[model samples]
Target chain A: MSHRLRILSRIRKALDAPAMPSETARAEAVAERIAHPPQHWPLRSIQTADPEGAAQLTLIGRFKAQLARLGADVIEVGSVAEIPAALANYVAANVADDAAGLARIRMGSDAFLAALPWSSTSGLEIAAGMAEAADVIGVSRAIAGVAETGTLLLVSGAENPVTLGYLPETHIVVLETGAIVASYEEAMQSMLAATGGRMPRTVNLITGASRTGDIGGKIVMGAHGPRRVAVVLWSA
Target chain B: MTARTQFDADIDTALADAPLQRALADVPAGFVAGRRRAREELLEFEPLRRVARDIRDHALAHLDLYLEAFESNATKAGSRVHWAASGDDACRIVLDICRAAGARTITKSKSMVSEEIELRERLQDAEFDVVETDLGEYLVQIRNEKPSHIIAPAIHMRAEDVADVFRRQHGHLAPDRKLDTPEEMIAEARGILRDKFLSADVGITGANFLVAESGSAIIVTNEGNADLTMSLPKVHVILTSIDKVVPTFSDAWPLLRLLARSATGQAFTAYTTIVTGPRRPDDPDGPEQCHIILLDNGRTELLASEMRPVLRCIRCGACMNHCPVYCSIGGHAYNSVYPGPIGAALSPALAGAEQAAHLAEASTFCGRCEQVCPVEIPLVSVMRQWRSLALEQPRSRRARVMLHTWARLAQHPRIYRWCAGIAARSLKWLAGSGARIRRLPFLHAWTDYRDLAAPQGGTFQQQWAQREHKRAQRDRADVSAARARKSDSVP
Candidate 1:
């Protein structure tokens, strides 16, 4: 027998000792659980019963608060058009001046980011591709924001490559205000709905900039990833 | 020396190591205290823990079905799924994949399963330049030492020790560079590892959870190295066990919620990546090929055994953080890939009772591990089961004899009380005025470290009997007085 068969048979034998349901019954039970997952666990911080707009607002508020606590910067812009200026201001303030004196922003070919008016902002060099080693700042668009944990859900594809999130010292995530959700469960459901039940190649639920406490138990941010994660939350 | 004696010597050596002692002191203040704060902040932590346990149990109960589901879904998603019955088999499979990819350089994130299989040494022996990307794991790699702690691999080393190691290994750099703080060390390691990430041909990691629903492999990390590992290389391989599979994304959320909180007191880790398959055809960047190696490594047998709850461990390290034995001796002394309460129960189950019985006997049954476990695994009970299995061995003749004598005496209450009273009286007499015994005959192990407090002149049974008699007398007097008061009221 093959290793897979042998292993499965071993598991069956082990589980056979107990008086369990039939094999068909077990398969049915698994299928049932997967088809209809349980409701979201009640999180005290976010009220699930609020109106849609209010709930989104609550999620955005909670999301910002959680991110702030983790040392992330959240910048809210009035509209998509203001993002370039916001990004430019953030870069000027946080990122150290390089020898070029121009901020280089590397990003994937995401439609949402590409549609933005970036040429209006001066001293900003924009490149549409995967991040490189010398890239100082990388920007990507998040599909959804999780409120309870302040997480960003980024799917990997040609539109938003996974490398852009980890390679740069400064990571700028573009999250629309309407895309913020109350919990991971809702975000997952939305993702499934968007993909027609087929999962994307990669789904990254990023909470903050990369950090490590392995050295003397002291937390040092930007360990092998972005040191700073700046979320530009824009509303229409 | 016998295994028992050698373990004792290890304990003594660990206790005497001053640097280790200093490092161990941080466990309570770091992981333990952090978990407490995280748990306190979440109002639904207790209920969520129960949900997490149930999810794990349900998956394990029908593991065969879930494994099949995961295999089918993953294969459909363009990922090649491989099965290995043991660690050696898993290592060979990984090497074959690397060889097929013509991988000259391999970068790995922190994967305890990979460590369990000793995969790095195997790969390096085949001349693959393997690099550990996690900061803690990188430090341990440079020192040529096994990780002393699961979450914090270099927990045994001080900042200065790390600096010395870096200085010695990175000799091409200036010798007198100031690497004093963790910040400096982190920056230096990051710069060095960034090049490895960009240059590696294959990246390897371990999955915390495998979603049977979508055929996704999820890895949780505070550092972004695992992301870079899976993203940069042309080939990505995930080394994980069969027990990591969950039914759906919903099932994964609860476990994810408990993991970071229990491990480091964070609401969420910095990165939780779920990879369904290889990169899409149009993707700008990601591993072109993805492989999932499902390793059994004696886990199926473990599932059949009475110690099945040991499989519920999520590798949070909370059990170890709260374990008294672990806090004292540290992870190295356990001499197992996993260490502490979970290790005590799991090592015996995986390696067999006779070979690793000393690990089971190393616990004080303080119950802190179970108390802090996110899955609520009965760790103490599992360790006790291992102890029972150990007693049947021929080498446990002395222990069996002592237990047999105690059991016989325990069956008869009068004889047990009489012998216990005499023993307590003698101990009290030996203790003199201080009521502390500085030395004990045939039990120097207990007295060698600290003075054992003498029993207060009698056994527990004698003291309980006396208290019961006095309580009965007091109760009768109170009833009679209540009756007298009622008669006076009637007159």
Candidate 2:
């Protein structure tokens, strides 16, 4: 028998010895659970205690607060048109003035971000492609934002390469106000709906800038990924 | 002098190592305190733990079905799934994949499964350049040591020790570079590893959870090294076990909720990436090939045995963090891929009860591990089971005789109380003035480190019976006095 068959048979025999439900019954139970996965209790912090719009506002507020606590900068802009200026301002404030030259912001070919008025902003060069080793900053559009943990859900595709989030020294994500949700389950639901129940090649739920406590038990930021994560939350 | 066991020597060495002692001292304030704060902030932490435990239990109860589902869905999603009956088989499979990819350099993130199989050394023997990417793991790799703690691999090292390792290994760099702080050291390592990430041909990681519904492998990391490890390489290989497979993403949510909080005291790690398969045809960048290797080295036997609940472990390292024995001797003393309470319960199952008997004996059975475990595994009971299993094996005549005497005495309460009372009186006589016995006959191994407290002059049953008799006499006297007072009032 193949290793697969041998392993499965061993598992079957083990369950059988324990007098557990029959294999057929177990399989049906598994199938039923998968078809209708039970919903767990939502976090009390994100429970809806007001109207929809107010609840959304509360979510965005909670999301910003949580991210701030994790050392990520959250910039609120009036609309998409103001994002370039916000990005430019963030670059000016966070990027160190180095002798090597102008700060270049690498991004993917996401239409939502590419269609933005980036030409209006000066003093920064914009490159649209996969991230490179020399890229100091990379911008991507989050598919959704989870308020429960202040996480950004980014799916990998042509529109948003996965490297853009990890390669750059600084990561600036653009999240629309409407894309913020209350919890991971809701964020996953939105993702499944967007992909017609198919998962993307990669889904990143990033909560904060890269950190590590491996050295002397001290948490030092910017270990292997972005040192700083700046989110431009724009009202669409 | 009585001959000391290897386990005793290992503990003595660990306790005497000043640097290790200092490092272990920080764990309570670090991981332990951090978990406390995280738990305080979440009002529903207990409920989430219950749900998480149920999810793991349910998944394990029907693991065969989920494994089949995961295999089918992953195959459909362009991922090749391999089943390995043992660690050697898994390593052979990985070697074949590397050979097929024509890989020279391989970059790895922190995977306890890889450590269990000792993958890096095997790859190095095959003449492949393997680099560990996680900061803590990198430190361990460079020092030619195993990870002391699961999450914090370099938890045993100090900053000065790390700098010393860097200086010796990184000879090409300036000999007198200032590497005083963790910041400077981290920056230096990051600069060196970035090249490895970009140039690696294969990336191997461990899965924190495997979603059978979507056929995705979820890996959580604070440094995002695992992300870059899987994303930058052409071939991404996930080395995980069959127990990691869960039913759905929803099933994973509660586990995720409990993981970071239990492990590092964070609401979430910096990055939690769910990789379904290889890169899509239209994707700009990702691994072109993805392979998931499911390992079952003695786990099938464990599942069949009475210790099936051990499979529900999520490798969060919470049990170890709260374990007193683990805190003292550390992971290296256990001399296994896993250590602490969970390791004590599990190493016996994996390595067998005979060879790993010392691990089960290392615990104090404080029940702290079970209290802190997110999955609520009965770790102490499991350890007790291993102890019994170990006893059932062949043993010395002295040990067998001692155990037989203990069993016989424990069955007869009268004789047991009489023997205990005599022993207690003897100990008290030995103590004389001081309340502690500085030296003990035939038990010098225990008393060598610390003095033992002398027992009181009576057995526990004798003392309790005397106290109860006095209370009964006082109650009767009070009742008679109350009756006399009532008669006088009636007249």
Candidate 3:
């Protein structure tokens, strides 16, 4: 094993209070729990011929419809191949009305946008070169369709950065049917097993809109995250 | 800020607070009963706890790999990742992102980390119109106050108090609205926040968990506001501590079970949404941009210490509900956003022991917090660690000396016995005619409220020793007589 992985293994062992089963039984137990589980929304799993293609199409269709319902303009990109060109065009279109927005477009053009804000723009920079771009960014996680709770689990340092989840006003998550589990316990067990017993540092189990009942018990949605949520479902 | 902590002369002050005392009286019964019922109802609760604890421990131990994986995935998904080493850095990252976005109005969900960082004051200092959308947060925000509790931020305020605030602030819409019921109050607040949600240029939230497997920052709220916050704004920024990450969506189950049940006795909250990166191709009304700030304010340092187990806390609020001190003094007494057992340990560590020296001493060393913590954080031991630190100051020297003197006196049984006898005699004399004293100097605090009855003349050890001695004497006499009779028979 690699040194880092070995150290991780040692730590995992130290933290574990011997689960009553041997390794084989442990795996079997996990599989059993996954098969039949506790009270939660009904989960539907899908096996697709092309997972990426299916995910993209579902997300695009769902987001457009949801945004249209909320009375917002929509932009469509078929693939990562089209991101740069699309982003530039998108920036130019909104430039006249939003000067700061234009600067963001200019800033985002750095080799690495991380340094664009403070002007040390160097290393691993991906410039947005006159391509059609998006003002709002939405990322989809492997989604779960299990309960009335309509929850999603966003782990920090995963396919979507924590920033993308919260920085955008209108965030769209594309959820796969297979990601939904029967209960919270099932979710954790699956996560633990998948990462070879190492859990992610942060797991965001988001259910419903970003809201605050803070102002005198008022229920206001969109307090801090995307004010609207559109969940894209792939057929099982 | 108003209530004194355990180390302050405020121990007595907090004990004397009648309103706080009344509010706290229900904690032991309410939390204890609810927990007992919850456990009884769910047979798998213990297993669930074990699973959750294990999962969190595993994640924290191998945090780097998962964090790397999450960051890579997020970038590929088109979301920008900003790594913050401290609370200040985290806040700065968010502010910079918004400044770049030219965001004028920012709406927020209730985020405890933001509270830890004092994010609101900092953001307001920067001139952004930050509005708290959570009802509890809004109430406290309107009052220019800090949250009194974690789950119920404005837990200290009564319904009528909320009504009064609404009447003053939301007068335009609800001029004649009477906040008689929780439902009515909720309705009024709803009307006011809807407008703000629509107009917000940016939305910031704290994630309960950040899934590394898929690079998502997830939020769970009873009200659907978190969903809207995650979905509506053009810009979405998640401010979260690095510890919030888990490996994958599948691993979120066990902890989620514990979180909802422990927080408010629900099987599950109303909403749980997973957000990955910014909107992909063909997407409609999602944020055009998304940013995830992975904050590491003092956490990486904490990971190297004995204090690391504290990171496993899921923020379930079980410890708070069961804490006696918290019940009596409430959250404001701790003087930090986090209150109760967790706060007692966390505040001192997060904001320097000097700033929160009194917090650790506030405990009666009650084990209820540990007993109920879903994550099983050894809170009492952590509090003791803080106490050890607090004891290093000169002010604690007197207490240390007194304790040492008592320890020395307690070593010799004879001295202990003599002291006990003297104490018993003095108390008996003071209680002449079998009446308890109404008060005593230096002990008036205890005696004024309730009398300490006089003990029996002899101590338990003394009585037992006398009985043993008399039995030995009787045995000797009997043996001698029996030996004499045997001698006579032989002759």
Candidate 4:
């Protein structure tokens, strides 16, 4: 017998309580388990009213605060048209007066990046691809954002290259306001709904800038990923 | 990767290492404070832990079924699933995959299973250039040392130690570069590893959880190196055990909720990546070949035995973080890939009782590990079980003889009290006014570290009996005085 068969048989014999199920039976049981989700999750709604009443503003405020708390900066804009100006403002304020004068960035030219008017930002070196080691900043789009933990969920694809998320000293992400969810469950539900139950090749849920405490138990940012994560939030 | 059956000697060495002790001292303040703060923010923290525990239990109860479902779906999602019955088999399988891919250089994230199978050494023996991408793992790798803790591999070392290692290993770097802080050191490592990531033929990461429902393997890390490792390489391999499989995402979130809070006290890790399969046909940025290697290295026996509560471990390192023995001696003392309470309980089962029984005896039975465990595993009880099993084997004749004598003395109350009373009186005589025993036969190990307080008076039973007699006399006097007062009132 193969190693797989041998190991499985040994485990079954050791268990010795019931006969091993067939593949069909196993699939059914799995379906049953998935259909009946486990309980005791703290993510349920406590108040029984419009979840979007005053809580929408509360969630937006919480999301920005939590994101800032986790070493991320948020720039809330009124619409997608204002995103380019917000991006320019963030760059001019934070990265314009660098040791090299202006900031250099590798922006993933996804649908989101393509939508932004390029002529707006002057004196910025922005290329379209995965980030290289020499790149000081990376820009990408977040598929979704979680308000509970201030996390941005990005899907890996031809447009939103996965490397653009982590391969920079500073990472700036474009997030649409409508995609923000109050809890991980709601975020997951919306994501599944959008994808039609197809999980992306890679789903990166980034909560904050990269950090490490391995040396002398000190919290230091910019370990391997971006040292700074700034979100350009688009208001619906 | 050498397995030391002499756990006592290793622990002795660790206890003597002043640097290790000092490094361990910082653990309580760092880990405990973070967890407390993270938990305080969440109203559902305790409820999440219960759900996580139940999810693990339910999954393990039907482990065989879940494994099959995971394999089927993962295969459909364009990933090969390999099974290994033992550590040797696991290594051979990984080597075969590397050879098939013509991998000359491979980068790896933090994987305890890779440590368990000694994969780096095996690959090196095959002349593969293996690089550890995680900062902690890379530091340990450069120093030619094993990980001290599972998560925080270089927690035992100071920043000076890292600087020295970098200077020694990366001889090509500018000699005068000031590497005083972790940031400078991290920057240096990142610059060096960036080239390796671009060049590595394969990347291997450990799985935190495997979702059977989605055919995805989840990896949780603060550093984005795992992402870069998998995203940059041509082939990505997940080296994990069978127990990581959960029924679905519904089951996984609870464990994820408790894991980060229990670990470093983050609401969520900076990055929690869930990789479903190999890169999609249209996907721009993932490995073309993604493989999952499931190793059953003595875990099948654990699943079958009464000691199965241990399989519920999420590898959060909370148990070891709060373990007094671990904090005192550090992870190197355990002499296994796993260290702390979980290690003490599971190693004897994994490595064998004869070779690993000393680890089970290393605990103080304080149950701090159990108290903080996300799954609420009975860690003290498991350690006790291992100790009992060791006791039955009678490995050391002197230990067995002493235990047998104590058992005999403990079984008889009259003889025990009589002997205890004499011993107490003699100890009191020895102690005098100081109230401490400076020396005692067969207990130098205890007295060596700290003084044993002398018995101030007679045996506990004798003292209780005397107190009871005084109470009876006082009660009778009170009753008689009450009767006298009543007769006077009547006259």
Candidate 5:
């Protein structure tokens, strides 16, 4: 017998319970689970535990605090036009070493970010493609943000490739205050709404810059991914 | 290391190794304290644990349905799912994939199932250059050792040990180069792994959760190695077992919430990527071919057994992180691919209780493992079941005689009390001066490790009876006084 058949038969024999659910039935079961989740007590507890529950300013405050806590630099901008100045100012202040000479930037090809006024930025050559070794900065517009954990939910496609989130030395995330949600559940719901209830190829939920505590239980950031994650919170 | 079957000898070896003892100290100071602090931060930590446990149990109850759902959705997403009946089968499938990809170099993130199958050894034996990207796993790989802990693979090694390993193995580097600090070591490793990541043909990672709702595989990592592993390679193969599938994204939240808090006490891991399948046609990057090997190596039988509750394990390493015995002797002593409380319960289930049954007896029965377990696995109870199975095996004459004597004495209370009184008095007399007893008759196994507390007085039954006599006298006096008061009131 084939491996799949043999394994399935063994599972069946061992269970001795009943036949497994059919394919369409599996989808139906998922729909039912989502609609009437049996385990909502924890979610309820989370809701009751929160003091400033989903108040817009409170949610944005929590998101910014979490982002900073994860070692990501945050700057609230009044408009999308201010993003270039934010990027330029961050480069000017943080770029101390002259070892790399001029720093190049990589941004996602997503239309939302592509429409940004990048021509207003001076001295920084921004490229729209996958990050290269020389690309010191990466700016990608997060589709959504989780206020509970300060995580950016970036969907992978031709427009917003996932590597831009992990590659480059510094990642500058562009997220609007309205995009920030209260919890992962809210984050998932918004993504479902955006995708028309279809799943993306890859959903990257990056909380902080890369870090590792593997050696002697000591944490060292900038392990393999970007050394730093900067958030441009366009609040207006 | 001795053979994996010699768990007793392995324990003795681990106990004597001063370096391993020192290394084991970090776990309690790091993972234990971090989890405690993280729990304090969450007001509903305990309730969340209940939620996580129920989520896992519900997932396991409908595992067959979820697995089928995952297979169908994953297939529809342009990924191939293969079934492996055993470890060898899984290895064969991987090797075949490498051959198909013409892969010379393989980059891997931390995967315990891959360790269980000894994937590295199998790959190297087939002449594939394999690199473990996780710093801890990489250190263990170069040192020719298995992971001592599930999450922190090289927790057994000190910084100095890693420095020595890098010096010896990284032969291409200048001999005089500084390799002292963990920072320096990380830099060196990062530089070395960067080239390998770019050049590797296949990237293999383990799924923390397989979302059946969207046919996505969830992998949470701190160092972003899994990200690079999947991102850089042309082909990505997920090495996961049959039990990892959850019904949907919502069902996976509670587990994810507890996972980081329980593992390293982080609010969230640095990276939590959900890959549905291979990259889309319009995607700028990601593997071209994505294959998921769902290995059912003894898991189906486990799922079908009374021990099915253990299938809810999320491999968070929380059980071992808080295990006192594990903190003392470390993970290598268990002699199975897994180690610690869950290891004691799970090894037997996966490797047959008959051969690996010794693992269950390695615990102190402290119940800390169960208390800290996010999935709320009754680890102590599972260990007891394994002990019962082990007892059914043939035992030495001394063990059989001792057990029989204890059972007989326990059955006859009068005789047991008489013998216990004499024994207690004698032990008290032996104790004599000071408090502790260096030598004892029945507790040789214990005194070898720590000083045994000498008996203070009579047997527990004798003390209880004396207390009862005093209580009875007090009761009679109270009743007489109440009767006198009643007569006075009547007059």
Candidate 6:
């Protein structure tokens, strides 16, 4: 056969793959707070929380390993109170008397609450009130895999703002080991089933950074959003 | 500063530039390296090329479907879609939009379609401040020049040349400044453009891929200017050819794969922002109004011709980057906005054969463009087609007569041989002793670098035939001996 014919045949095959499941089922699978995707809500909760203390320590170690692989500069603070100190030291060392860098960081991060001069009780509400707060706040969603691209899906509930995934540069995703899904199609099916085929108001499946090559064929990363991507995978 | 539309004379002048020749010479070495790197890194590179080719072919086949889908989707998303059947129509549409928006200052990203329609002149005629945002484009724009290389608009410019231009243009602003380095120059441009980005009323950009499925126009850029251009401006206008539209995102993926690698050997663009529509009500930053001008401009007509394969071009500039002729003359030598191999084919299609006749003659027909074309556009063939078209014009009476005289004389072998013999004798006599002529009126360009070697006493064809006659006698003797041996053996 000719080269064109052979290529057309391959495309036909890719398009003709059997329908896996309903879109609702895939969406539900993606939205669930499992360690991975596809386990029932009750069963996933069991895996997300260690039955004993043994698995909890093991999962913490795994989270640290993933962080190292992602090449993020890690700082382990004892509590939320110490987070301000950690961030200040980071800002001082990296950025030297630059308001622009400070502004960028403030715009990028979701957890910029403790450092601001708000009253002790006011906390995150003040950071959220900032005009140019992060573009998206990413939350961890246990989805199978993306149906089209192999993107990690995150759904927003009441605690998790939808903007976390899209707005913020630093995606402080608290992912448990049980939340990994196989494919996007399967994740979509689960998501659909859980939501009764009604997709979220804002669903973000992030693969990489916000990039464009519009200027003289040069690809500049982080145009509107955070150029820096930091993922915080932790035990449930 | 303005670029001339009458490119024929300007191109002839640029064809003589020395620095342009130097720049062209460097094209092959870098292009080979970049393409090889991309191929090695992306295992799916070839597959993506095939997929992209198929997608483009499919789209071209069913273009009406996708065009309708794109129009409706863009319209539904609150973007006004305008149809332009010609380059003039496209320019008129953009000018009308600018006039209506009260756009005194317009910042434009690199759009080949805009260049195709000579948009800057049109906009300037209407008295609008049009600034080119792309660095290479900015350099070319400031100098009142057209792009020489499609990808690197200022590829032919030397650092010293650029420094001089900058000094002349920006000396008053930083009169005491001593600028020497490229970094300094870049910083200066960045500082100047920072205010331009914010103050612009309208932004015009080019689309890499127009996704019909979601009514999104994808612009791939390395600089953050596109985002600023789109977000800061009240009115965002996209000038794109009809061929840019694709069926869906799935189809877009393969083309994107080939485009980056073929253009600059990047795995992916730094920013591949997909603008779906005008900013939503709650959205903080984005254009209030979006308009996508779908410029046909003889593309549909080209699609109906033998040169239809030329539309498969993703504008990667690989062909130009790899082209020997393009490297030497630079883009200005071609005199048309689109230069290099793809330009050689396309300019004639968009512009009339009469206007762009000289462009087709710019190519060496070396087939480098075709070899490096990711979508496999038969660039050389298209160029040859243009050559034939030019030849058949019937207007060039002198040229036609000359060709006719040569053709009529060339038919009779005896006459042609006699003419060749006389010409050879004269040429041999002209060379004092060494087979070199320092200067000859008609042959000056040909003999500039190297001398034409004198032919032997006889033509190769005649010499070969004589040798064969002698060899046939020897062969006959051998055949007789072999036949005698065979007869003895049979007995």
Question: In candidate 3, what are the lDDT values of residues B25-109, reduced to their tens digit?
Answer: 6555554566666565455676667677777876776666667667877776677888776678778888898898898888898
Q: B138-185, model 6: which lDDT tens digit per residue?
A: 888888888877767777776667777888887657676856755556
The 10-residue segment of model 2 chain B with minimum total lDDT is: B1-10
Root-mean-square deviation of every model: 2.9, 3.5, 14.8, 4.3, 3.1, 11.3
Error of 5 at B245 (Å): 1.0
Please give each candidate's TM-score: 0.95, 0.94, 0.66, 0.92, 0.93, 0.70
- The TM-score of predicted model 6 comes to 0.70
Q: Please state the error at residue B252 of candidate 5 in Å.
A: 0.4
Instruction: Give the per-residue lDDT digits (tens) of candidate 4, residues B208-249.
Output: 999997789999899888998899889999999988999888
Candidate 6 lDDT at A92 equals 49
Clashing pairs in 1: none
Instruction: Give the interface RMSD of candidate 3.
Output: 10.8
* Candidate 1 C-alpha lDDT tens digits along A116-230: 8998898789988998899989999998998887899998888888888999999999999888888888887777776687788999999999999888889999899999999
**Candidate 6 per-residue C-alpha lDDT over A3-90 given as tens digits, one digit per residue, 9 for 90 to 100:** 2233233323322325533545533432231113222122122221222332244434433433343233445555545544444454
Which 10 successive residues of model 4 chain A have the least lDDT summed? A46-55
**Best candidate, TM-score-wise?**
1
The superposed Cα distance between candidate 2 and the true structure at residue B69, in angstroms, equals 0.6
Task: List model 1 lDDT by residue over B91-125, tens digit each.
Answer: 99999999999999999999999998899999999
After the best TM-score superposition of candidate 3, give how far the Cα of residue B224 lies from its true spot, in angstroms: 2.1
DockQ for each of the predicted structures, in order? 0.61, 0.61, 0.07, 0.51, 0.58, 0.06
> What TM-score is obtained by chain A of candidate 1?
0.91
What would the DockQ be for model 6? Answer: 0.06
Clash pairs, candidate 4, are none
Per-residue alpha-carbon lDDT of candidate 5 for residues B1-491, written as tens digits (9 for 90 to 100): 32333776777788789998888877778998888877776777888888777778767766666777788899999889999989999999999999999999999999999998989999999999999999889999899988988999988988899889998999999989997887889989988988888889999999999988778899999989999899878999999998898877778888898899999988788899899889787888999999999998888888887788888899889999888789878988777788999988898877777667777888889899999998889989988988988888776688799999999999999999999988887877877885787777776766666676777667899789999999999999999999999999995
